[model samples]
Target: MQLKIVLAVLGIVGGSAIALAQTMQSNHGDGMDHVTHGQDKPADAFGLTEPGQGAFAALSEVVRFLEADPETAWSRVDLTGLRAHLVDMDRLITDTVVSETELPDGISALATGDIETRATLRRMVPAHAAQLMRDGRWAVEVSVLENGMELRVTSDDPAVVARIKGLGFFGLMASQDHHRKHHLMMARGNDVHAH
Candidate 1:
């Protein structure tokens, strides 16, 4: 039973790696179809397999998906919009200075940066707070200040409160699996932020 569970978990995790590898292979047309040919190729032969940095890897994945789809509307594809969103993410991660305060229920985080970063914070924090609220776990609130953005997260359960404090701002932002689907939609010219 344990082995079966482990295999099931691995299958779920490995599915993405397999899809990525196939996408990379198809994009490159390297004449080596490992899935079909059963070639015992060295893993290193597939380049770094790191797929570059975070934003680049994400854009690459989106592009690969676009390329793989036969019905993809190239005319409707909006990579520029996707790139802008990725830039906002980069600013959020690299530019912001975050100070976290412990709260009885969870934590309060004030994230500050330059003009661009502050704008990013104002735009993203509340959106993420809304996303967190949907899980029915944590109560997240956001305030946009002149120089910074403030996020307050709390929970009813003591353990969840502890988890909220541990996660702080960034981990909370990274919590959901909706990001991948959101990116895909954005790349396909859909306004994911539209209410």
Candidate 2:
């Protein structure tokens, strides 16, 4: 029984990874496919919420600068450094897999596998995304319950949830959500609930 359980977990994880890779490959060359959604449109104003320093703060600042003055942002911001930050984000996304023991007390112990950080991010974006962009310390916790994988965004900031509902889901947040979700969901599919 133990062996069977382990095998099943491996299968699900493996399948999710394969699916994610295929999805990314399909969307890679299509440039305009991203724009039709209008998610990348520039914001004319900056956020009023007080932000603390971290990845989120940096991202929010850069986004404000970009939207307020795209010409200057294009000229002043370090595009290469931004790309490196994204690469770091990629690593953070994949590494966020949770373990079975981390589940709550009542959840059935039978189901076991990653919650796939990228997957949940697609269906429902983290409200504290700006903070996440600034610091990878925060994570979306996924618990392997018997019924399904429970997904929740866990952040140190108490204001994250409320702030997410506001008008700040801009460029950094958009790119992180789309790209990360594309990778996580395509691979995981609805793998979270499978027995």
The candidate scoring highest on TM-score is: 1
TM-score of every prediction relative to native = 0.74, 0.21
Show model 2 residue runs off by greater than 4 Å. 1-75, 95-97, 100-195
- Per-residue alpha-carbon lDDT of candidate 2 for residues 1-195, written as tens digits (9 for 90 to 100): 999999999999999999898788866545546645346554433334546644455455555545665345244345344434444454334444432222221111122224454443433333334334454533444344443344343345545443433312222244344443332222222222111
All models: lDDT? 0.85, 0.42
Distance from true location, Cα of 103 in model 2, Å:
5.2
- Model 2's alpha-carbon lDDT is 0.42
* Candidate 2 least-lDDT 10 residues: 103-112
Worst 10 residues of 1 by lDDT: 34-43
